[model samples]
Target: MANLQESNHQENWENLSQKTNDSLIRVRKVLTLSRIILIVFLVLLVFLFLPWRQTIPGRGTVTALRPQDRPQTVQNQIGGRIERWYVSEGQEVKKGDTILLISEISQPYFDPELPQRLQEQLQAKQSSEAAARQKMRATEAQMSALDRGLNYQLISAENKVKQSINYVKSDSADLEAVRQFYKISQQRLERYEQGYKDGLFSLTDIETRRLNVQNDNAKLIAQENKLNTSRQSLLNAQIELDNIRVKYQESVAKAQSDMGTAISGQATAQGDIAKLRNEIANIDFRLGLYVVRAPQDGYVIKTLKAGIGENIKEGESVATLQPKEPLVAAEIYVDAMDVPLIGDRSEVRLQFEGWPSVQFSGWPSVAVGTFAGRVFSIDRVSSPNGSYRVLVKQMVPVPAADEPWPVQLRQGSGVYGRVILNSVPIWYEIWRQLNGFPPSLEREPKGDGEKAK
Candidate 1:
């Protein structure tokens, strides 16, 4: 019985060892298959999806080729009511073309009053000048008449003085003759008195001689009185002559002064008329600033004030104009995370709106329907959308052998592009992304080592 039990135990142990060997073989086969499948999947992923050319993608819009190529706004320089419009929206116009007409606000017929007032002022000045001239003429005539009267009076006074002097001379000569006769009569009386005392002459003869002497004395006295009267007349005539000369001089001076004053007044009146005329001319010039004209040759993009009767203020926008020809540009925005990958003059690939495109990130040579471009500028600050702005310039298209080039892009059309960056391995990119690391960790190259300084 002991031998049989030992035999059963040995057989059971051997069966158990054989089952364990089969299970180990199955486990080894399963492990080997899993390794082979993992290797194949990794090789396929590297070959297909790993990007060989790292790029930063961005979106943008088509814009004018240059900033100055954009539309220009036209404004009214003065406030007025629109009278007429010569051009409409979208119309082509040449430089200096009349664009519109504006009329000044209506007045109550007396608001300006400048023209009527100027006319009235001019007429009044003219009338005043004429009156001044007439007064001057009257003054001159009066002066001439006074001059003639003074000349006549001066001549008469001179004649009277001459006559008085001559009379004085004649009276002096008569007085001398009377004095000689008196002396002779006194001598005769003395002779008669001596003869009477010596009885050589009669008494009657002596008395007659005495009477003659007395008569001679009386005649001498009368002659002396006449001389005095003549001297008085001469003095009076000289005084009258002096008075006439003084009066004449004073009148002449007064007349000349009055004439000068009248002439100056006339000149002032004429000056006032000239000044009024100049003011009227200035008023006329102010009325010519009501018309508006185009400042340059362009096409009207939009009309801000289109109503004919609309009132517009000074410096208000009236219309928008666009140049006849304009170049195209792309305005793109890059996210903050990808902005460090872009630089000025960086290589770019753009796909326009309405155009189909296909991109092979690893092999850009096989890209289809996409145009080449370059990054022209990048914004220093983020925009309101939290993205950095970028401007791009499109390079000339090089179409495939059997493909046609894209049509011209319109302004403000949607666009998208890729900013090509430094080349990197697919595995590294994947590892970085999985670990929440940046796309690239390498520093930018400094040009000629100058940036370090």
Candidate 2:
């Protein structure tokens, strides 16, 4: 029974070995077929998509990141020991936001005690102006009084002349009356003397007549002399009045003119003082060398090798500012051979090595990729090694960040970019030659449609 069992076991083992061998052979064949299929597939993919196929003509492209158009921030205008900071590092600021305060120290045009001195000077000027105004008023009052006095003096002189003339006229009239009375009395006395001599002897009546004739002769002589003296007095008074009136009118006119001149001089002085005050104020504002402000609602970048107590020279860059919108711009050098291919308004295709399959192209980006943008400009001169440099603007929204703009524009972010030259036609050289001008092509006269070079 043991021998029979051994025989059955050997046969079973033989059958099992055959089945195992057949299975191994089939597996080998399947593995060889699979290898062939994989090779064929790989070869097909290479032929269809390899760059060497020359489906499109392109130069080796240089990659770079887009740069910001505006600078990170404007430097401070004033240089001094920062007295006080009005804002924190990352603070949102408006157009006219005050970023910091500098202590009012002595500047080029500043005195140590300028503020106090200015105040004192202003007060003194105020007092001086007031005093000057008061003096002007007093002078005007005096001038007015003088003018009035001169007029009165002239009037008095005229009145005196008039009185003198009236006296002269009365004297003349009295003289005339006295002469007439004397003549009439003499005629009557003569007649009476003749009648007395021819008639009877009346001694008392003759005596009375003689006394009247003597009195009339004396009165006439006195009246004539008084009239001559009164006429001389009237002439002297009229001459004095004429001279006094001329001098008074001249003095009054001069006084009035002088008052006006004084008032004009005071006004000019006031205007000059005001202009000087304004200039001083302007100088005060321009006293500092630098002005610092918040940069785009962001934190101050304090990475500079400077300290608060350090003395900074003029035009020295103290600190860099970080803007809210951070971008990573890579500057790459392109060869001269490739420069002409890349120009303004070209489309660039970008590939991220980190995200192998991800790409960026065109104005509107697709699939979490940045868009292509026009070239901002190209350096007129090439690099020292004859490599050309071109600056391009990238159409990409800034990546979202919790930090603000000032903090985001930090130095050294890694980015890659490609500059798009153009989608050149297959017959680019021929097309350029045909469309070129001057010796190559010219516009046809009227009635002609299209012309070629």
The candidate that achieves the highest TM-score relative to the unseen native structure: 1
**Model 1 spans with C-alpha error above 4 angstroms:** 1-39, 45-51, 106-297, 396-407, 441-453
Clashing pairs in 1: 65-327
How high a TM-score does candidate 2 get? 0.45
The residue ranges of model 2 lying beyond 4 angstroms of the native Cα positions read 1-69, 72-117, 159-235, 242-296, 299-305, 308-317, 326-370, 375-453
Per-residue C-alpha lDDT of model 2 across residues 122-153, encoded as one tens digit per residue: 66766666766776787788778877887797
- Candidate 1 residue-wise lDDT, 280-350, digit = tens: 78667646646676767778888888788889988888888776656677888888988876767776778
